[model samples]
Target chain A: MLTKRIIPCLDIDKGRVVKGVNFINIKDAGDPTELAEFYNSEVADELVFLDITATHEGRKTLIDVVKKVSSVVFIPLTVGGGIRTINDMRIMLEAGADKVSLNSSAIKNSAIITDCSKEFGAQCVVSAIDVKKEGDDWIVYTHGGRNKTNINALEWVKNVEELGAGEILLTSMDKDGSNNGYDNELLEKVNNIVNIPVIASGGAGSLKHLYEALKFGKADAILAASICHFGILSIKEVKNYLIKNKINIRL
Target chain B: MPDISILNTKSANFHSVKKAIDLYNKQNIITSDINEINNSKGLIIPGVSSTDTVMQNIKDLNLEKIILDFYSSGKPILCICVGMQILFENSEEGVKPGLGIIEGSVKKIPKLKNKFKVPHMGWNQLELVKESEIFKGISTNTNFYFVHSYFCDPLDEEIIIGKTNYSIQMCAAIQKNNLLAVQFHPEKSGKDGLKIYENFNKMIS
Candidate 1:
């Protein structure tokens, strides 16, 4: 059976982990490698390192962070932020990233999806779409949910799949940082459109929310950030909850 | 430790494979040179591209003969994903001929009614059918990471040692005498994945 994944996402800034990671066990909660190792030890199915620092120098350091984390963590590693070209994707992949997530750059130039997928198989490309609800229709937002695109969320999901994206990282801007639950309605709608795996992100306040995302939303994976980072939920706890709920999970 | 040559067809993440094996303290190299591969105790054809591209790359690197030679020489050979698919006669995804070491044809996984995805990405369990050195320390039904759109269909089912299900029972791992291959990437499979490399090293020395 193919198990659903519980991924711990780390927001990296200037090559260091940020975004309210307050783990008492980790001496340096700011370190990317240590946080990655902690998550790996807790049995995180995968890890995503998003470079919040969009500066040129930050890009160079993110590569270093990816190399260090991949050296220690054996699971799949995905790096995003400031990935503008196929060459940028190559640099991260060469640094040992398994997949490169495309967010702002992907929306700025949708052709990068086709080009990256062609150069490095479709499985290596992850399209991250941030969306906001607007009168029953979801709007695609870029620049970390700051700028809105004219693309409809469902239409964009279908177009992304046709453009050769292997996976979709769908985030609900309203649900994100809200501590409510994943937007299962949006997730289910996107899941219905794309045959490829959809990773449900934003608004995972508890284990039940994760369950609902997989059960009601049918998302292939759940991207847990605040819950795991704040120690409210661990990756193992999420997997355990899913297993108890009759979900096929890697425990 | 004997040298392990990860044959670089100029495709796939052999570096990740090299990293995994390095944890086992194995001497390995990622190279396309025929001599380096022939001299190594084991050869790993790590693949992550279309069959046509990998096959063409093998020919370009002049590794087609080298790979066939190593297979018959009784040296351990590990083929990954597309690497495993290319061992068959041919594939539906690509037109180029495979190495034909294993009598099989690669076919695309059918799209089920919203139940299963095409790439079959993410973690999936392994159903061991027969004992093989590659899975010496691995458990049955243990999840391993996989990302591929097609599956292998061997003419002789007896060669299949590992099986997995997405929508159908597809061959996940295979072994024939001294040759071994897996549809999943052990290097990307965490602890159990590293164990696969450790077991592969055991096959070497």
Candidate 2:
């Protein structure tokens, strides 16, 4: 049976993890390497390191962090943010990331996803879409939910899959900091359309939220930050809760 | 520059496997290529990860016949980690069939009641269960690094040369005909690990 993964998302900037209340007002969490080792000890099913630094030097710093984290953590790690070229994907993977998540770069040049997937493999490419509700429809947002694209969220997801993305890491820009719950409506919309694994991200406050995401939303995986980074929910505790809820977990 | 000689359909990082070979050769260990085993030189196929997938990969590359040819020639073939598991009949992890060089299927260590991790993930000692050229320098309880979730259950019990207790009488090493395999990482297993590779080197030499 395929295990429902429990992932912890780390927003990295300049080799340090910075967690924000709602993607703003960042607070230094710790060294990226240390956080990675901690998560490995906690038996996180997977880890995602998003390099939020938009500068060239920041990109170099992110690669350094990836190399450092890979040496310590044995579990799978995925790195993203500011990745523009296939060489970037190759370098991050060679640096120890099991997968590479592409957001803005993918939106800019969707062919990169297919090209990278062909060169590497589908299992190694992740397409992250930031979605925010626009009236009766969900619109795809880029630049970390600041600019809404003309494309619908569901349509973008389908496009990504057609482009050979192995998985979709869907983030709800609306419920992000509210912790009200996952955008189940949006998740279902994308889930019904894409055959690849769907990882729900943003707006998970408690275990019940994760349950709702997997149960009602039918997400293959859950990606949370505030809940995990702030000790509101540990990966083990969440997995245990999910198991009690009859969801498939590695534990 | 493609550094990997074999494009594994599963794990394509042939560079790392080549690195392991280069590191072994630096220690004065002679490693034989897969194409040369028929002429009497032994061949080493060390697998650090992905037993089931690697087996599928070999079949995908259409190289199983060549491997069976090596086995038929009575040349020594060493399997390391998951590589050892592929020497068996099947594995529970994937639907792909193994080489059937040995008689058993690989299955996960039954869910243990205690906290000994599934992949084992670290170095542990190998206690000899029988005599073979592979265990020449390795002593009783000699530590060798291991990282795997599945084990081989050779149909012929006599071929089980050594056992390492993780959950069951796990086959640490198996020897039959000219085939030898170990469930530990020799490249990362320190001096003793190097000797295990050296023993293989001697066999092939």
Candidate 3:
């Protein structure tokens, strides 16, 4: 049996780790390379470095940051943002990224997922979705949740899997930074519709939230930011809480 | 003639073997090329430093089909440490799809079971699970070096040829059809380990 993964997501802007309340009010957290090294020592099962500005900046892969983080951290590292082509995926993977997450890119060119998977394998590709409840329907958000796709969140996830995505990083834009908890309804819906592993991101306020995500949502992994970044909770604390709650985590 | 090939990427595992192979080539022991692979006999698949990057690196080098091709040709392939894991359908370390050439999943030795520090780094013993060509002439319970925490669990039990009880009855080696893989590092495992290599050499000879 596979142990459930606990991941810390580092939101990066101009190579610096930044955190915001609901994806705004950006504040510098620390040096990405330094923070990544810290998490690496904490036995973080995996790390995600999202270039929050890459989409707006029209950049390619986060080469320099990826190089710096990959050099120091031996654990699995994933990078997202501005990954538009197979070449971008190749660069990130060559730079030592274990996987590349596609958000806006997947919506723009679904074919990119298939092509990248063929070249780099499905496991190397991840589909990141920022979902927000739009009245009765759960709408999929793209370009960092600035625009809404007409597709339902569950259907969109299914489409990504069909395109050969190995995993789904589902984030609740509405519950993000609210410290409420994960969107169980949305997660359960997506989890049921998709067979691939779903990593619940966005609303992780407490260790209990993580437990709920794993237990109720059946999430294969959880991605947390503020609670972990501001030192309110450490990875060790989170893992300990999960263990006490009878949840499986890499000790 | 057997169609053999080397599978690895630019990871640390790939680096060491690449260095070793470079030394062999510099000494005129062998030539490095896929076509030459068929002439030379058995294949050499090196380990990945961690399970995380295996899929990308393997896909980056276009190794899966190449491996399946070798398997279909009935050539014996030796998977080193993590290389042995490529045989499984999946790994707990990553969400990547394994070759599934062997019917099983690769899982990390449960923390509840592991007494030794992970990465299992150093020489250990291989308690032969059963008698087979891979272990012929080698002592049944001879000690061979090991450095991995994850082991293969074949869906078909008959393929498991050897085991070592460290924290669990971990698989030391496997043989399914023409395919063979070992969780231990043969290149670093010293003489007894080399005997297993010698057996593989004799198979293709």
User: In TM-score terms, which candidate is top?
Assistant: 1
Q: Pick the candidate with the highest lDDT.
A: 1
Please tell me which model should have the higher lDDT, number 2 or number 3: 2
Q: Write the per-residue lDDT of candidate 3 for residues B1-205, one digit (tens) a residue.
A: 3233355455534333333333223221222345566454567777645555766776876666767777788877777777788778888877888888888898877655222334343334577777778788887666554555578888888888888765667787888777888887554333455566567666765
- Fraction of native A-B contacts kept, per candidate: 0.78, 0.00, 0.00
Candidate that beats the other on TM-score, 1 or 2, i.e. the better one: 1
Question: Candidate 1, after superposition: displacement of residue A163 in Å?
Answer: 0.6
Worst 10 residues of 3 chain B by lDDT: B23-32
Tell me the docking grade of candidate 1. Answer: high
Taking the tens digit of each residue's C-alpha lDDT, what string does model 1 give over A132-188?
999989999999888988989999999999998999999999999998999999999
- Clash pairs, model 1 backbone: none
Q: Distance (Å) between predicted and true CA of B33, model 3?
A: 4.3
* Candidate 3 CAPRI-style tier: incorrect
lDDT of 2 by residue, A189-227 (tens): 787787677889888888899999989998878886889
**What's candidate 3's DockQ score?**
0.07
TM-score of chain B of each: 0.97, 0.83, 0.83
Write model 2 residue lDDT over B1-205, tens digit each, in one string.
1111222334543333334445435332222244333343555565533555577567766767777887787777777777788888889867888888899888887646532334443345577989999889778776565556678888788999888777666888999889888887665444566676567666765
Q: Which stretches of model 1 miss by more than 4 angstroms?
A: none
- Cα lDDT, model 1, residue B102: 93
